[model samples]
Target: MPVQKENVSTAISSDGGSGVSSDRLQAVARGDNIPAEVHKSVFETTPVLKINAFNLWYGTKQVIHNISMPIPRNQITALVGPSGCGKSTLLRSVNRMNDLIQNVHIAGDMQLNGDSIYDSRMDVIDLRKRMGMVFQKPNPFPMSIFENVVYALRIDGEKNRSVLEEVCEISLRGAALWDEVKDCLNDSALKLSGGQQQRLCIARAVAAEPEVLLLDEPCSALDPIATGKIEDLIQELRGQYSVLMVTHNMQQASRTSDYTAFLYLGRLIEYGPTSDIFTNPVLRETESYVTGRFG
Candidate 1:
């Protein structure tokens, strides 16, 4: 297979957990603000997203190779690749959205907290709750702004007025949109601007307290200023939640992520700390792409 471009994994057969393997994918341990050597702290004690020998196929076309990597807790991990290289495909795999496709076949193991999410016994709803997704375009409900954030919580069986309002407030604040829309909670969400609506979607994602937040080209729809606002929001979200974003913008990946993984034709060519990946890549493909050699 050219660069791990195996068949795309089918969500029906996939556990949908994230990461490469427990041992190889865990977050690097023992860093003091930063570390000098990338390989020394290879041993990981805690990891939030783990995948092992994962392969996927959309009917007959393979997308992701036998890719493996660990997502550190409460930090941003960016997936960068050229168009049609399966960046979005791999991101969707994390939450099992691939199952919605017509023909899908998934192979390999994915784990969360050492539990197999692909196992048939796993609760799909709960699994989705643990992994929230924010799309490129904001898709707020037609209802009031308040309902947009409260909708997910309502589904999770929280009917209490007080609890719902509290979650709404906290989630909006977490998404950096509360103060802007706090006064018009009852207003229709459509009245908001593009950036505001995107933040609203983010608020909606966080309302359920998801463990990992998946963002698919979220800022591609916004302008520079709005993009900055979303970037700032991601930084604020780091300490409280894990974030995985797929983007073609190299600058955005450099600015926002703690770790960066470069994929070429669906195979992960390199994965490492953002600083090293940007400043001094260990792989030839990464160097070429980062240095404008080729994508």
Candidate 2:
């Protein structure tokens, strides 16, 4: 049996759930905006992360449809879409961040390295440890810079001072903030500039050595210079870690991602290599959205 795409404008169901319109989604996918020569190419490499038949709802409002995609290992995949299209919802779902919200229900399967993440035996604390997340704003703790970077390590019962220092230095350098904040390791993290604070947060996330990193509009609140620094850091982190970022900035998506997925009204409309999606999209809606015709 074929899976049906829901419409965006469907009325609320008797169960008080909002359903996604696959018709709209398929229409976008089959739309005529894409060039003829470019076809969706399959990557032979194994994916480190995969989602299949995924769906989610806040109370009765379903925000994510039956999304299925694979996030390749050692590569950057950007999720680009309009506001309220469930981009953040999906990002947070990967690490089970959505569990924090009240009345949040999730369905479908999300796997890491072929292991089910929602299994009853799955330890969320351990799951989160494998994946790091950076938010839209720079949220540094009130503690000193050094403490901020290695906070996770301390919480995990690492007591060696030398080990903490080494990890702190490495993480900060990985986040491109070592040179700027090396001398002020004892200073309060909150006192740093917005850009510095954000980098510090990244350093903190990387300190735990997570295999995958999730970023939710990490630069939306930053200036061009700060954003560029984050971008460079992401570029540097590629191949060493799998990075999945949700970004509204088209240029940033184009500049940073190897592959791109565009979502509309909470459904995946198009996904492919960045070059193909941006230069020669296979869907008319994708072309229109990417070309600024309509979001």
**Highest-scoring model, TM-score:** 2
Q: Using Cα atoms with residue i matched to residue i, what is each candidate's TM-score against the true structure?
A: 0.85, 0.87
lDDT of 2 by residue, 72-182 (tens): 898899998888889999999999999999999988989999889888899999999998899999899899999999999999999999999999999999988999989
What are the RMSD figures for all models against the true structure?
11.2, 7.9
Candidate 2 to truth, TM: 0.87
**Model 1 — TM-score against the truth?**
0.85
Top lDDT model:
2
Judge candidate 2 at residue 50 and give its lDDT.
90
Go through the candidates in order and give each one's C-alpha lDDT.
Answer: 0.78, 0.83
lDDT of 2 at 139: 90
Candidate 1's residue-wise lDDT over 6-52, tens digit each?
Answer: 22222222565432322211121221121112222222625688877
How many pairs in model 1 have backbone atoms within 3 A of each other, for residues 3 or more apart or on separate chains, i.e. clashes?
A: 19
Model 2 lowest lDDT segment of ten: 31-40
